[model samples]
Target: MLHRVRSKVYADFVPEFDATSVAKIKAAGGIILGKAVTTEFASSDPSPTRNPWNLEHTPGGSSSGSSAAVGGADGSGCAGSQTGGSTCRPAAYNGIVGVKATYGRISRYGWAPLSWSLDHVGILTRTVADGALMLTVLSGADDHDPGSLREPVPDFSAQMAEHDRPPRIGLVRQYYQDYATPEMWAHTEAVANLLAEAGAEVEEIPVRGGPPVNHSVRAADYGPRIRAGMEMGMIIPTSAYLKAQRLRRQFRADFSEMAAKVDVVMTPAMPAPAPRDLNTTGDAAFQVPWTAAGLPTVVVSTGLSELGMPMAVQFGGPWAQEGRVLGAAQWCERIAGLNQAPPNY
Candidate 1:
């Protein structure tokens, strides 16, 4: 039987009502396995949930508990929310599958809000198939969530139904490679070769514009530093924020054009594997761009890092292309041959 655990954000903040995603899970015959931990208000504040891979290491957050639980034997899967790397980062850190569908792809009706513009409901599970199946159940427009997109919900599972050939994957190595540890870069190259050997047409691709510059706007609701910035955001002049929004639209346009040339874009999910520190979740740099552009992204474990912790690669597609993004991720998941159980599990 399948179960969907809620995060602490839902438990502590809004216990009375099931988030739209949670309601969908129950309707689809999934058990509500109770709430997992979340960072304080889903921000920089740390949670008690440690990485299952290494108890001393950090489990990425604010979706910490969701990812950690899904990485364990006790839970089947859980609903995570990502404003930045909350979804994909934790999945990568814990060595599991995580999906951040396009912005508004999954209704946020009852989910707690961070940056309304950037927050997205996400899925963390053991496999791409499970992620897609859960996504199919959780996706669709909700009358209550004004931010919800009205696009038709396709059978996400069927979209991932096997393909005759591997996908043409575009490698965007500039920012990702620049920020990643050498070991991560090398591991990524090795995985690319593994995929190519399995028949994925891999090619280098150039990128314009770097990571999004509005972390302040997104992280405003968080801790002191970010909250200070959030306070500034309140008085930063509407014109400036509007200008940033316009620039963001152009960024989205550029990414869409780029996506036209490939079945999926691949990059390291995080600059490095789960950091040894539990003081903070790993950096969100690898995920901010896609989240900023509202593109669909999937994180799959590539293998364990040098420390025997998991390493992962994230694949993203144009907006609302969850099916394509997930399909490619599913293929890579199979060929990468990295799905071993974490030690101690």
Candidate 2:
């Protein structure tokens, strides 16, 4: 995927895989499945893959093929990447599990950067367990990625054990109630209520002032950063970049502080399910804050939309808390009882 995108005629000098990363994947006993399609540099542009549920609609991108390959009618459990809502949106659109691990959890040594500050390496799969398995194999710090954290990797798969007691979950007050579609919001609320009824402590929590505006600015400005690197032969401006970094730190701190009181934060994965039109990808507003904070986020399909398209809720956890996040997501998956492969491939 990296090689092909880098070779494109209009390729704008994005990152590419070096031999060392490929050697490492092989050395780790990983085999290459065929590459999945991505949006240009994993940004806003939509791709050609059709949603398995309805071929006339989009499958979502920049990880379009990965999600379709996994949750499409074939029932092949596959993995894909997410930066903003790439994995989660498709998971919601196609009815699957997509997890965007905390930034630096997976090595960014090989991915083409959409935004150095906001980019995350993630996975899309048929179930939370499948997503967790892929995350275990893919995650770990790498010297090649300066942004990679040196923290010890957790055993995510082991954390899948079902608990007798329900988890304490928090719903960000504004996300579902305000920004999401009525059907999407209703499904998320229903899941929360189900968790509560099943012995979980589910409650609303305010995010205070909400996500930083500069985060979006930084994401949008990344194109210029990549272009500047190519044209001027200079690195990105540290001061400008660091401002976003500082905001990221603030978001992480705030999110962690909130997570101290809750096992997981839940909200609709996207404002709605897949839109019928293929000309544009849907919103990323619901995903940006979590991405900027570098929090572990999982998207679990609740079920079909009013239009019978798929929809999902996102679960987020504190840094390095992917195990708890995945476990909670798995629990939700089992309880929701909505896991089903898309109708047509």
Candidate maximizing TM-score: 1
Extract clashing residue pairs from model 2: 39-62
**The 10-residue segment with the lowest total lDDT in model 1:** 1-10
lDDT of 1 by residue, 163-216 (tens): 425999999988888899999999999889989999999999977887666554
Worst 10 residues of 2 by lDDT: 1-10
Model 2 spans > 4 angstroms off = 1-31, 73-79, 162-165, 214-244
Candidate RMSDs in order:
3.2, 4.6
Which runs of model 1 end up more than 4 angstroms from their true locations? Answer: 1-14, 162-164, 216-226
Q: Using lDDT as the measure, which candidate wins?
A: 1
**In lDDT terms, how accurate is model 2?**
0.72
